[model samples]
Structures are given as structure tokens and as C-alpha cells.
Target: MLSQPNYREIKSSYLITKEAIELAKLQDIDTKKYKELLKSALEQVLDALGISFDEIRGIKKMDAFF
Candidate 1:
């Protein structure tokens, strides 16, 4: 398990990547790379938390994060 601070930091990084994806979309730039990165980061975090992707449905902004 990750320490509380480490977990928070990881989650922050994931959110930053999510924001980058949105910004890229707004700029009409291809967001494929950013989306892939966000997905990978999210998968890792979910694994760390022992949570399934399905468990977060409707709780998080799926389009932004996935």
C-alpha cells in the first residue's frame, strides 16, 4: 500500500494528466497520447488501491480520465 502522502501525489499526477488531455482537446490537438498516459496512470493507481475500474464508474469523469 502507498503511504497517504504518496497516494495523494500519485492521484494529483493522474489529475494533471487528465487536465492535459482536456486542454489538448480544446486546442484541437490529438489527445491520443495523453489519453493513453492517463489510462495507464489510472490503472496503476486503481491497482494500488485494490479497486476495479468498474467500481469508479459515474464517480469520476470517465471521459477525462480514460
Candidate 2:
């Protein structure tokens, strides 16, 4: 199991990625490929940590609404 500190770190990273994606969109940058790659990486990390997508707040499922 992941420690609380580690979980927080992962969560922070997830949020940062979300922010980056938003920023990229605002700049009219084509983030399709990058988004897919980041999403995949996030999922993998969450799985490894045994954390569900629902475990994180302030973000939608797989950023579908983004």
C-alpha cells in the first residue's frame, strides 16, 4: 500500500498534469497525442498505487469533459 505522503504526491502530480492540459488547450496547442499519453500514464500510476479514479477530486473521469 502507498503511504499517505506518497499518495498526496501522486495526487499533486495528477492535478499538475490536469492544469498543464488546460493550459495547453488555452494556448491552442494540439494536445491530442500528449493528452492520451498523460492519461495512460496517470491510469497506470493510479493502478500501481491501488487508487481509483474516484479517489481524486476536482477532476473528471479520465478528463473526458476536458
Candidate 3:
């Protein structure tokens, strides 16, 4: 589902995933804030990447992270 191009499906999946994580938090299954942040960030990245192909035009020069 993460690799899917359909925007509504992507959003639905994202919401479902986010809800599950939030429920887990309430249950004390995984309480680390950083873990939730990381998960949310990855979901955002997946959604952004899924939508970006249409707007992309050219290559981006790569640089090493410091």
C-alpha cells in the first residue's frame, strides 16, 4: 500500500497506521516518543515520495551529509 500511487488509498493507509500507533501508545505497548516520531516521519516521507513523481523534472546533485 505504501508504494501505491492512489492518493486516497495512501491517506487512508497513513491514517490507519497512525491510529494503530496511537492506540498502542494508549495501551503502553510502545511509549517512546522518538519511536513514534520516527514512524510518523517515515509515513510522511512515503506520502511525499508517492506524490512527487508527477512534479519531478530533473536530477538533483548528490552531496554527502556531514
Candidate 4:
């Protein structure tokens, strides 16, 4: 199981990456492929950490994009 600090780090990184993808999309940088790749990677990490997307998204302090 991942520790709280590790989980927060991963989650924060994912959020920042997600924001970057959005910026890329706005710039018309072909983010479709990148978004798919990011989702797959994040899903794998969440699975490995025994975390759920719902749980992450449900955090009141954060505004998760997806």
C-alpha cells in the first residue's frame, strides 16, 4: 500500500499534468493522444495504489479536471 505522502505526491503530480494537458489542448497541441496516454498512466498508478478516481475527485479541496 502506498503511504499518504506518496499518494499525495502522485495525486498532485497527476493534477498538474492534467492542467498542462488542458493548456496544451487550448494551444491546439494535439492533446487527444496525450490525454489518452495520461489517463492510462494515471489509472494504472491509482490501481496500484488502491485508490479510486471517485475518491480523488471527491476531495473537497481540489478541483480535479477528470
User: What's the TM-score of each model vs. the native?
Assistant: 0.36, 0.34, 0.25, 0.36
TM-score for predicted model 4 compared with the true structure:
0.36
lDDT for model 4 comes to: 0.66
Tens-place lDDT per residue, model 3, 1-66, is 556566445243333335554355556546588676766666666676773322332434353233
| lDDT (10s digit) by residue, model 1, range 1-66 | 566754653333333435554355566655898777777779889989987665675565476677
TM-score of 3: 0.25
lDDT at residue 44 of model 3 (Cα atoms): 68
Model 2 TM:
0.34
Ranking by lDDT: 1, 4, 2, 3
Clashes of 3: 0
Count of steric clashes across candidates, in order = 0, 0, 0, 0
Quantify all predictions' global Cα lDDT against the true fold. 0.67, 0.64, 0.52, 0.66
After aligning candidate 1 to the native by TM-score, how far in Å is the CA of 46 from where it should be?
Answer: 0.9
What are the per-residue Cα lDDT tens digits for candidate 4 across 1-66? Answer: 566764653434333335554355566666799877777778889999988655776654355554
Which stretches of model 1 miss by more than 4 angstroms?
Answer: 1-28, 57-66
| Candidate 3 RMSD computed on C-alpha atoms after optimal superposition onto the true structure | 18.3
Clashing pairs in 4: none
Mark the regions of model 3 whose C-alpha exceeds 4 Å error after superposition.
1-31, 51-66
